[model samples]
Target: MSKLQKSAWFNLGLITISSLFALLCFTVAASKIEKGFNYINVILCLAMMCIIIPLTLIIAKKKSYEAGFDEREKIINQRATSLSLSGLIITLYFACFIPFVALGGGNIIKVVYLPVIFICTIFTYQLIKSIAIIVQCALEEQNG
Candidate 1:
């Protein structure tokens, strides 16, 4: 497997694990924490972020930028990054409204879950982007 693929799989695996943990935050601790949009308990979500994000950057940097990218492949990566940025932006905007949409003005669980969703969504974006870039580069290489 290529360096890019390794990076993607590493990110996907790490974030998938975290995403499940985040989902569990709702189902497991929803009743345990005091309610009503509490931001304090977002600490667990923060812990996940603090742990996973550095790992992602480290893996991505170690990923072979040595692959000697051509213009088309570079373009593919650029486009993928742009798309990921767009995804995070949209997630940020929409997450802000979660409280307004919940009818009862949301719960602390939902508050906690919002960052989880955003973090997972960003991971999702990065994974898809890297995969798309790898595929596009492979196809371009084969055609030439």
Candidate 2:
């Protein structure tokens, strides 16, 4: 696989892992609070982000100017983002049902759905990029 493809796959994996962690935190927090913010969960989530940032930085460090990318990568990233955004919009469609926000971290369904939203966004983005790459390869073979 090309470097970009490999990176995309890697990112998909990271998103999955991170999402699982988020879900675990939400669930644990929800169980303890039963519909409220558990300070522990918030802290955990924050810490996770802290950890993720450094890791992302490390990945960026591995790539230099040449590894930066070209038009194809940009297109792939664009499609991936677009797909995730569509999913997000669809997910948010449910928000209209939410009577009031002032959630203050005290809603069972909301807590459960929060991680899910992240999952949907990440998966959609990865899926689009993966599909795009496959289609590109198929077209190249046919044309060649």
Candidate 3:
């Protein structure tokens, strides 16, 4: 596999595992907290998972000066990035408007929901980008 493809796969795996781990931790912690649920704890747990972004970038960075990317790879990357950005926009639109439409203008949303929305946006972007890259690469391989 090409470096970019490998990186995409690594990101997909990292995201999947970290998300599952975070969910498991949250579930266990929530069960144990008898007093009541805490938004801070949930936010902190998600923020901790955000660390994976930098970690993925560091791992995916090219070690040598010559990062062998051809025109096809570049095109694939561009297309995948564009597709992901489009997905991000759609996700944001839904996230922002859905509650507003459902609840009307006078209703208030919790402050804690802001962080949840941000995290969900980030996940949506990454998920779309990774899936796009993988699918595009596979299509190119088949066409060749």
Candidate 4:
């Protein structure tokens, strides 16, 4: 596999695992605590941000820059990025509008949901980008 494809797979795995871990932690915390937005939630959020995010960035760093990308690779990267951005925008649109439409203008959403929305948005972007990269690579391989 190419460096970009390997990175995409690594990112896909990392994001999936971390997101599932976060969901499990949040679910446990929610069940145990009657009151909302407690210390456990704060700690879980901090752990995700401080640990998983940085780890992902470090591991997925642009080590391929020294090698330089050829035309096909460059095109693949651009297409994947654009697809991810489009996914992000759609996720955000749904996240924002769904709550507003369901709850109406006067209702207030819990602050706890903010992190969930953020995580979901990130998950959506990474998932789409990773899938795009993998699929593009497969198609290129088949065509050649």
State which candidate has the highest TM-score: 4
The lDDT per prediction is: 0.62, 0.59, 0.73, 0.80
lDDT of 3 by residue, 47-113 (tens): 6567656655654563351257788888888898899899999999999899999999899986646
Cα-based RMSD of candidate 3: 4.1
Candidate 4, which segments miss by more than 4 Å at Cα? Answer: 29-43, 63-67
What's the distance in Å from true for residue 65, model 1? 3.8
Better of 1 and 2 by TM-score: 1
Which stretches of candidate 2 lie above 4 Å from their native place?
A: 35-43, 51-67, 94-144
Greater lDDT among 3 and 4 belongs to 4
RMSD of 2: 5.7
Rank by TM-score (best first): 4, 3, 1, 2
Model 1, C-alpha of 10: deviation from truth (Å): 3.3
Residue ranges of candidate 1 with Cα displaced over 4 Å: 25-30, 35-50, 56-70, 97-110
List pairs with backbone clashes in candidate 3: none
Runs of candidate 3 exceeding 4 Å displacement: 20-66
- Per lDDT, the best of the predicted structures is 4
